[model samples]
Target: MAKKLSRRLQELQQKVEDRTYQPLDALSLLKETATAKFPESAEAHIRLGIDPKYTDQQLRTTVVLPKGTGQIVRVAVIARGEKVNEATNAGADLVGSEELINEIQNGRMDFDRLIATPDVMPQVARLGKLLGPRGLMPSPKGGTVTFDVAQAISEFKAGKLEFRADRTGIVHVMFGRASFSPEDLLVNLKALQETIDRNRPSGAKGRYWRTIYVSATMGPSIQVDVNGLRDTKLAA
Candidate 1:
């Protein structure tokens, strides 16, 4: 049996026409449809032409949203000696070494982002089973594994997002909150588009970009004009 849509969701869906819209117009519609009681997140769903099953075709990287993620990002760090203090001084919400690993093993996931120093990764690797599925594992490519723990914590707290293409060749990311202005959301979306293009896999074939869509967390998806988004240039 198909799950029934909420009355609010049904009404919101009706407002979205079946047509691709310009980036700004799509974002505006996204805002208009975000009528949830709580502040909903603004998200982007992009389909790319690549197969991650092949090593060379994989796409995994991070983008810094200029307007920020519009939520408090709790950061946890697993480090040793000096790096632990560095993480703390940099405003890490939680900091520890072995004890931290043990806590996560016992199912304490209080933080949104986790960072670890390079030297501690071997030990941190033990928690992969617990963290990988939840996207909490510290990865060098994701900029969560570094000796400069302070900088890593600072960047993540300031809206640095790690994203990758799923098995279906689509990238889903939350760029900001629905409470943010459409212009602010557009800035973040543009950054995401540029980042995806910049990190295009060497093995990806023709027509790398398939489609792009944006929506509020509880709202209907709005298709975005791929060509229009690509042609957009923001002022320096």
Candidate 2:
């Protein structure tokens, strides 16, 4: 049976052509095609040429969105002593030491992003079964494990995002809200792309970026013309 699309989605889909578009054009189209009443996020889906089964082929890192994610990120910091105070003073939504870990283990998780100090990892590690599955585990690679709890908390609260390729080698990240100007979205997208490009796996062979698509939270995916997007004139 054919999957049914809503009338709004159907109409929105009509605005997207079958061919790939320039990055800026694709972003503009994504914003134009957003039909959600609430502010929808602009997302990018990149398919890379790599097998995650190989450790060296995995891509996991963080990117600071130039224009912000446009969504408030609730940050949780698990630290002790002065670090806990530092995190709280740095604007962390929730901060605590062992008690916070107990709360999480007991099924109380209210924050979107979780940061922890290096020394507390021994305690936080116990929650791996719960946090790992939710992508909330603090890893040094993700910039969530650090001594400067304040910097980590501030960066996350200021639109830092962690991304990793899934088992299938696809990375989906939110660039900004559909309501943002096309230029803003374009900047954020380019920043994310550059970061991903810089983090390409050394073990990966052949073409790296297989495909790139942009879409709004409730909009149709628009194929991005890779070559055209690389054009200095348009990308600039």
Candidate 3:
């Protein structure tokens, strides 16, 4: 009985590690799932938060998502000088203190999201009301609040995404919609997972990752129970 229970627990844990869902390669599993329209809520999207660990080379990772973020971003910044100019030149929608901070504070602005630099963080606290409730605030965990304004803005326009975990300690993210090709979805899914893994906290409970699942926009949530996810390395 003890052995049986241990095996069952191990099996369940493996599903959490099965972070990738490759449909083309696993047609048998695909047939078991009924297709549906993409979900409208970002709540079902999967995301991983990882620590950069002060590494310089991991600065940027460019990936062409098969399915986009499904939401539009109205980026705002608090930086000045070349950093400010650099963000606007790249086509960010908003770039000034009065325009960005003032509107966010009054709770009268309409924008999808935001990204800020080291110098700009002080301004964001004031706009907490406008951006906070809407889930548009630039957070430390999201990689939006950094000294590197150019990279932040560039990735924002390029669909660089930030995600937070829910009460269940799980993050749902869109790999792609049902209409997307398997390859595109695969690349994106892997990229997002890698970024999250890099952000995992060393001081997490028992094992920082308690659970994981994946679903397409407007699709059912499927837990990943694949080859290697079940076996994870502990932080040194």
- Residue 171, candidate 1: C-alpha displacement in angstroms: 0.3
Q: What lDDT tens digits, residue by residue, belong to model 1 across residues 32-85? A: 999988899999999999998999899999999999999999999999998888
Local accuracy by lDDT, each model: 0.94, 0.91, 0.53
Q: Which is the winner by TM-score between candidate 1 and candidate 3?
A: 1
What overall lDDT, based on C-alpha atoms, would model 1 receive against the true structure?
A: 0.94
Candidates' RMSD to native: 0.8, 1.4, 9.5
The better candidate by TM-score, 2 or 3, is 2
Candidate 1 vs candidate 2: which has greater TM-score?
A: 1
| Regions of model 3 farther than 4 Å from truth | 1-72, 205-211, 226-236
Worst 10 residues of 1 by lDDT: 148-157
- The local lDDT score (0 to 100) that residue 78 gets in candidate 1 is 95
Clashing residue pairs in candidate 2 (N, C-alpha, C atoms within 3 angstroms): none
Question: Scored by Cα lDDT, where does model 3 land?
Answer: 0.53
Q: On residues 27-132, what C-alpha lDDT tens digit does candidate 2 reach at each position?
A: 8899899879888999999999999999999999999987899989999999999888888889999999999999999998899999989999999999999999
- Model 2 misplacement above 4 A: 232-236
